[model samples]
Target chain A: MEKAGWDGFEIGAMLRTFDGAIQNIATTLPEDRAYSQSSSFTASVADWRIEKPLFNKDYCIDCQFCWVFCPDMSIISRDKKMIGIDFDHCKGCGICVEVCPTNPKSLLMFPEQKDEESALVEWPKKVKKEKEDEVGEE
Target chain B: MSEIKKIKNLKEFSTSADRFEGANLLCPGCAHSIIVREVLNATNDDLILAASTGCLEVCTAVYPYTSWDASWIHIGFENGSTAVAGAEAMYKALKTKGRLKQPDRVPKFVAFGGDGATYDIGFQWISGCFERGHNMMYVCLDNEVYANTGGQRSSSTPIGASATTTPAGSVSYGEKKNKKDMVAIMAAHGAPYVAQVAPNKWKDMVAKIQKGFAAEGPVFINAMSACTTEWKFAPEDTIAISDLATDSLVFPLYEIINGTELNITYRPKNIIPVRDYLGAQGRFKHLFKKEYSYLIDEWQTRVDAKWEQLQRREEARV
Candidate 1:
């Protein structure tokens, strides 16, 4: 407590006080499970994603739907307006694209490998429900 | 009195410190993940959160590592309610002892548990919490099944949904009983506040949690948790599925004030047939078969009856 100058209130609330137990963590952790040290730099789950949501500022209505519904807090928002998707932690579930209330959705899902700029170029202005006849043509 | 700080602006709240954030192994689009964030965000004061053994506990707080930015503790499955009661009492004791310098730094006491824990396993402990008049909140992320330990049928699981334990076979139908009315049960405790909410209705959940905190005594919130893994839907369809749930009246959003007055929060523009809801998920796939189509109709009738009952309750305001 003296080193960090933490008061009794901090310790009582357990808000921001590092104790001896936390500093000297046990060396032998469970071996079967893949684990990291507590408060370690958490690894991103982006690798689990098959496709990523690409944000288009032009079409965005800033409805805040994407921000509210994002399970991962991946929808980066500023001043109540959603600006971008946090790819570092975002395991692209296409929820933002699903919840986007825009006609031509402000958020579009594209191949995970593609960049936002390139993905925006291919964004469908209006997604048409193609008849089975056209589907069979290809 | 000043209004509780509403999260009208996102930039105002610190992202990493204020609420539960990323870096856990919860599935890509679990609805409880969003619900957890909303519950945590509703409290402006510091928090001492307790999570029972379930999806929220195992996946979010792995021993010392946790996504929850608050002062979090991992408790046993049935310990959620009772544990928070102790915490709240301790806080009161600290206040008496003059340990806490700031008078308004009232840390919120909240416990979160899954359907398996909240609706069934830990219900006794939860009931005790309310009976004791503990100044705490218990939030049930009801996914309707034991999704953590591979989807088993719980009391909250809807009738006819095939679970691991209650598998649909040639002779045997799925879960034979109706989903327990957990909200009604919680309200029976005469807690100051009780409400049912879903993550799809973000504002409703936030407002309800805010009200829960504002209440004097114990508060119970039964939030619909859309478990994509067990419910057999695409991860992205979590919101749409939950929307369908409310729209179909399968899970109505309502609140019971002082454990007596009933207020229907959100009602569908046009109620969709329960068939559409039952057919959307893979768990109820067996009910769609030619031999079992009658069960769907039976379910629809029951759903209509339940909706009418709720409407009548709302009309009477009892």
Candidate 2:
């Protein structure tokens, strides 16, 4: 019923609105056979987390260990150096903390309610891990 | 085979835009999302992904909201192989009819199937796909359990690992049967390329994926996927557990080329005890008890035997 798309079929309709309430009213429904880009960026999983990892740039090795291991793309980085964590999307899994590597952990989990500035002031003392034989090379 | 571009730097290798936009609903430490992102990032061409209904599909695709940024399709749990073949067929037909938007463009096809989908329900469909020899890759994200429906035991679940359906108790010893040899079965299909990968080793995984894509015919890759929720390990310990699995030879990383050449890609410098791998997770906790201590020994013996067999096979190729 449509002209032969000699190149390809383009479903120009893309959904950007992610605000959906669980009400009696039927909200946005996924269209049948219609292509749409993911709108999950609009959904926040921050509330699902109980604690968030706090980053200390001074201790980071820029090895990208945390970045590679992060299941969620919450580790924000540029030019290999981790700038900060994407708090809005981070689920406080503390994976960054576990993978912080040989140096004094660059990242540590803190209560979500605690402010970073205050948390930094009383930051836990250096718990240096005994550097084992080189575990991983870049 | 396609020329593999050497990855000189990790920073530059993944400079491509993130394929996953925002967070969907995968658990904090689930390896499915990380593996998907890494696979998407490493490749250089457009890929049409067919996702089986599992953790990756359910979590990423929450109806109107999805985290996927690539051309993705959900084809249910029963027949990912058939869906992928159909998609590739469509792509070829469109190309021949001069309907392709880009004349020079060729989209590689990849189908992601959960362990349950591949091993339990969709085995025959996959076998048929392998026989048909479609120009596509079938990847089994083997997390060893039916993770989507609250962690039921699948064929891939290791002995002594408890799942919702296979409870470890005085009357029972977790899963009575051993984990199925999925890679061997896939290789038996005579696929030109077959591999077992653990995404924790990103470099190895990337290389294997590139090779799989480059292969001319059907290929199968069984990638180890660690489930933080069902596996009962801390979210942070996901990579650690996966690494341990490799070192303990519970999940060896290797590739079978032309279904005959045996290449063990990564070998442990120092083999870690099987206990370290078992103890790291809650599902295998019962295996440590006095009554079930023998199970650990059996696991170790089995692992050692398998490792030896792999080494022998690698030697035989010469």
Candidate 3:
């Protein structure tokens, strides 16, 4: 099941385990009230994106510089190989691009405005379609 | 020692081994991330972190999501030192009561706070903690203001710098008072270890963190962290600004041991003018304006005087 308000990182599942463990303490103790709330606070940093990284798998060295120096931890690494970036969380610091030792630079960043505009236009259409489907079912 | 040898070469420092968890939500160019990574890498032992309410705490430990691999506790803005002290006490108590059966188990305690919490709000608490001699490390990631509170002026704010509360206008020229000398205050409290460092020179900062962990009593490291958002600088200029601050002696890397010994860690070959540092950031841009240009000279004089004072103190210690 999708965790509401989270950016869909696999760590969200891990956090749920902690939420489960603290469920009793969270409910019983007033001091644990803060911990009781869902750990699903959206970092909401996607709006700050001015540039987004375009990763090229062909020239990648898998050194994980993008994963390492990223202030937002936007890059995802799996099995010792950096696979991709979580665009929703990436604040477009471009430290990854700066630190990448590759001569041609495997990771590149371009203006985020195009993606943002398309995404914004696509959202309401999807919502309207979903609404029409629900009305037809009724 | 192995860790020390590994970090000696910045290229060999692996991101995989870093204790700070990934996907942290700090501002893109925030220097605190580097500080956290370096400080955590200082000690090889299991760790416990106590963070006060600030940018690091709010952004890194956002309820369910945490950017730390170690056990972390948040006890509000002014309680970083006291909370860590309590945790240190609990660790000792557990060991004494045989609850922690491991014969060689020693977990290092680290407490973190911003300048707002450390310099002004938690001053008494931190002073008390230092006096009590807790076996913990306190790090003030001083960006020189209450940055987490939307760039408000704090006691740590430098003179002639604009902040939300100290905005430049017809009546006032940014912040009027000089930046508070929190390191001297900490040193006076007889802290076993007190050092001012910047992560721009990661090796120097890592060395201080190592020394801080090895110290017997309360140790404090004041790290100059550049905030790209609040300081009104380009994201890529974080490192550059930090280097400028160090190069200009605005944030000198120095240590005070046993409250008497003073050692300047890394001195620039030639001191750069304060304007190089100030003019690089937007906060101090107004100081260079024709009307307020005198403030630049005044600010430089203050920095030079402070640097001279440090030199005298270092010489006197010998």
Q: Tens digits of per-residue lDDT for model 2 on B29-144?
A: 88987788777776656667788888888887775566765567776787877898899988889988989877565667888989999999999988998998999999899999
- Cα lDDT tens digits for candidate 3, A9-120: 5553234313434322211321233321234223347778788876766567887656545666567665557777778667787767766666456776767865544433
Using lDDT, give the best candidate's number. 2
TM-scores for chain B, in order? 0.95, 0.96, 0.96
Off by over 4 Å in 1: A1-37, A126-138, B1-3, B7-18
Quickly count the clashes in candidate 1: 0
Q: Over 4 Å off in model 3, which ranges?
A: A1-48, A54-69, A74-89, A96-108, A112-138, B1-6
Ranking by TM-score: 2, 1, 3
Model 2 chain B scores worst on lDDT over the 10 consecutive residues at B1-10
Q: What's the distance in Å from true for residue B236, model 1?
A: 0.7
lDDT of 2 by residue, A26-113 (tens): 1111221122333676567999899889988777778787887788888876666777888768988877788777356778888889
Residues A1-138 of candidate 1: C-alpha lDDT, one tens digit per residue: 012222322233233222222211111111222233343124467788898888889888777778778888788766556667778679888778887877678887888888767777877786674532110011
The DockQ score of candidate 3 comes to: 0.10
Off by over 4 Å in 2: A1-38, A124-138, B1-6
Give the local distance difference test score of model 1. 0.78
lDDT of each residue in B5-68, candidate 3, tens digit only: 2355443444334455444668787888878877876656777888988999888777556665
Instruction: For each candidate, report its DockQ versus the true two-chain complex.
Output: 0.22, 0.26, 0.10
| Candidate 1, CAPRI quality class derived from DockQ | incorrect
Residue pairs with backbone atoms closer than 3 Å in model 3 (clashes): A39-B64
Better of 1 and 2 by TM-score: 2
TM accuracy, model 1: 0.87
